[model samples]
Target: MESVSKIRLWILQEGRSIRSVARATGLSRNTIKKYLKDDNPPSYQRQAPPARHKLCDGFDTRLQELFEQDQKRPRRERRTAVRLYEQLVSEGYTGSYSPVQRFVRDLKRTDAGSGEAFIPLHFAAGDALQFDWSEERVVLGGVEQKVKVAHFRLCHSRKPFVVAYPGESQEMVLDAFVRALSFYGGVPRRVIIDNPKTMVTYVSRSKDRVFHPRFLALMNHYVMEPVACTPASGWEKGQVENQVQFLRGRLFVPMPAFDDLDGLNDWLRLPCEELANRAHPEYSARTIAEVFEDERAELRPLGRAFDGYVEKTVRVRSTCLVQYASNRYSVPSRFAGQHVSLRAYAGRIVLVSGQDVIAEHKRRFTRNVSYFEPWHYVPLLDRKPGALRNGAPFVDWQLPDGSLSSAMPR
Candidate 1:
């Protein structure tokens, strides 16, 4: 095609002889003459070949039906391409798996929505915040344990707050939000979260979200509107999602070691502040800390903090211990066999009776580990001094240098 076009141009435009054009272009004089005489250049057109046979020629209808049937089934129950191929082979379809796979792929491409389009979102300072939770493994007190990490991020500044928890219960979720707001010194006008069971109780087909009673109460206390993302649409709260991954890699990696969850979280404070002090990705002119500072003024004032604890009334056992979860916490011996209010906090358990805090202990994660206060049993030990030798709770009891051992024989 190039030679023909060039020969025609040389002969007609440059007034060169056809024989000279053929010599210069390495083409026959007759070919050059034909190109010169023709108005359009000669070009080749590829002719479609006749339809050929396919190994899975007659299986399209069956395959399409199977795929359509799968659309009506649950995701876990849907058949994979390999499974469908095996089934077809069992049904005497004499084709390789590749054909069946390709057919399924093409069918999905045409039948399913090709792809999703997302619009970039923007938020004003203190306008919105996103929250999420992720699981991480860390060693605490020389024991490896799995922990849930709560992540919070301001949408405008990308500033983040992260804390570790023993569980993802509703109480923990509310506590995370309270701690995050307190750390930031203010609250955003709106809170965005995924449709987790902790926050969302129901999601209608119209996407109307019904939040949990306690979660709604928290929002009401903060005076912030709660916005839930569509189910399975994590991109709606993508900021916190990315923050979770970032913390998992940067802070959680190497498996942090600490004496307790409180110490780990306290250690995390400096790192979180350092992360905020770094240069912002979108606004390079200022650090995230600076941006957050600007946002703080726009945010709602830090009002009284919410009492984010789970409270329950439990009967004190004969051992002067209150049962919560699967563990027991000790109270004063006088309160034995009585009911007391147990408030489980993020780091401690408080026992209250008649408006008085009867006892407090560090919250325990392991089961059947009784937290005993030797002072709580002082009166009982005074009355039954001989029992101290074989008392299970007093097995590790010790006395001060000036004090006589009660377990010793009189």
Candidate 2:
């Protein structure tokens, strides 16, 4: 091609004769003249050979069938590409593994879900808020544990609030809502969330949703509509999804260390405020915090905060302890063999008998631990002083002075 172009250029542009070009280029006069007569450069076209069947030519149907059949089997029991290749080889397949690998790759690409279409969502001031939970690993109290972070974002202002929890239980969800509402200083008209079991108990095929009874009460109290996204469809609330990713990368990537969940949440306050104060991506002139100030006027005035706790009734054992989350908490001996209402808060547990608060203890995350208030068993110990020598509840008892300890026998 280069030689042809050179010959054409020399004859047409340089005003050189074809014979002179042929003499200098060592080409036959006939070839040089042929190129010179035509203004276009010399071109070569190679015709493709006739197609022929290869050893793996008809394997597409077979692979599709095999994959469809394997779909009915458990995930761990399904066949891999290599295993399929071996089976094909045993069945008289004469092709190399490369073709099979390419076929499998193409099949997976074709079978993947189609690209999703996203609509640009617009929100009025304080119209809606998105809520979600994201998991992160962090060192708390010198121990590494996976923590669930609750994320809330106001759609219009892009204002965000985040808090860490020990788990994603119903109690944590409600507690997060209370904290977020308080932080935002008001409640949005609607709360958007995924179809978590704690909130949405069921969704019919027609998209009719049934929320948990307690969650319904919460919605009623807040005077906000509860909007649940379709099951497995997270993009319905895309704002909070993006916020979760932003927080994981910006805040939790280094795996922040704190002495407790409270400390971690307190540390998050400054970052969250900074995020709000940053310039809004869409509203170039105003920051999120400034925009939120306008949205605040649109929000509903929040009434007294809800007592966000999960309540259950448990029978007090003869040990004068009520079991909650596989751990025992001591109550007054008078409540023994009686049913008491156990209210579980994010940071503490409160036990109530009838209308009186009988006991309160710091919430424990670990299992098989017992919390005892020595005062709860004092009356029983006074009645049966002999049992005090080796009571399970008194195992770690210590007297303020050395005199009382010396009077008791070991």
Candidate 3:
């Protein structure tokens, strides 16, 4: 093709003789002359279809088997063409990778659910809620950091609620639901969730899933059924998936900052309500807030709040401490050297002994630190009178002022 173009360029545009172009391009002078004389550029025609190579001749059945097996695996864990090529090499394939790569690419086009078509879905009022998590960057306490933000959407009304957290974990997930349900003032009949391991422990060969026990307890407490979306199917909970992007732009586009997560959440709460004032997407005549008002009656009454927590049993060490996440919190001295129930929430940790909250504290994320509720060590004072003055737990404790003490009961 380059020789053909040069033949005309030298003879026509550069004013060079056809003989010079023929000599430079290794074409016959007659051929150069023929090209220059034609009004349209010469086009090459294949005399016959390219010959087929037998490298993949015996591999069709094997390739199909591999492709089908891959289809059954989770999308992320599925084998790519490169991996397939490697596997074929180990299977004694003597062919170049190109044929195998091309085969796999073509094989995927015929796969089930490979089409672009999708069904439009509908939900009844209060039928379901959707949940998702996304990470956002914002200035927190003068430091730029990434925070995992939980998003919730009412499927029918299109009402959205969002909360920010330091991290996304099992306890954080449970707490987010509590906060969202509280914000909406009721629970929908069902909740559609992505297949996050924090909530869905196991997704079987089919649609069946083993919901994490704590997450199941949360759903049962609110009388709501939990539904897990199939892997890679965001459309199953498109409402919250869309909200994750929508709120990321609306709320964090400018890169918000706050003194703490709570302040950031407080700021987000108002805008959530304000956003509801806009007209609903499906019902343009009614605002989302108006639609939600209609949805409220359909939602189940907000019952007693679920004690959203992740519980673990831990033995209190002789130091009157129970360790969690590499940090320890003091329990009552009497419970020392005994196994107690440790209930961890997003913002707090509580030590419970047969329904008694023996100790509670603001949860800390720093590792290897100990948090002490000074009063928890009060019972130990009877055993050692001198310990209080030298106790590490009481180092930060201080007596009340005279004016404050006068108000306390004797």
Find the candidate with the highest lDDT and give its number: 2
lDDT of 2 by residue, 146-215 (tens): 8999999999999999999989999889899999999999989999999889999999999999999878
lDDT of 3 by residue, 75-131 (tens): 434566767777788888888888887777777775544667678889999999999
Evaluate all candidate structures by whole-model CA lDDT and list the values in order: 0.83, 0.85, 0.84
Per-residue lDDT of candidate 1, residues 74-188 (tens digit): 4434567766777777778986777788788888888775778888789999999998988888899999998998988999988888888999987788899999999999989
Report the candidate with higher lDDT, 2 versus 3: 2
Q: State each candidate's clash count.
A: 0, 0, 0
Worst 10 residues of 3 by lDDT: 401-410
Residue 213 local lDDT, model 3:
90
Count of backbone collisions in candidate 3: 0
Ten-residue segment with the worst summed lDDT in candidate 1? Answer: 401-410
TM-score, model 1 to reference? 0.67
Instruction: List runs of model 2 lying over 4 Å from the truth.
Output: 1-115, 401-410
Residue 211 in candidate 1, Cα distance off native in Å: 2.9
TM-scores for all predictions? 0.67, 0.70, 0.67
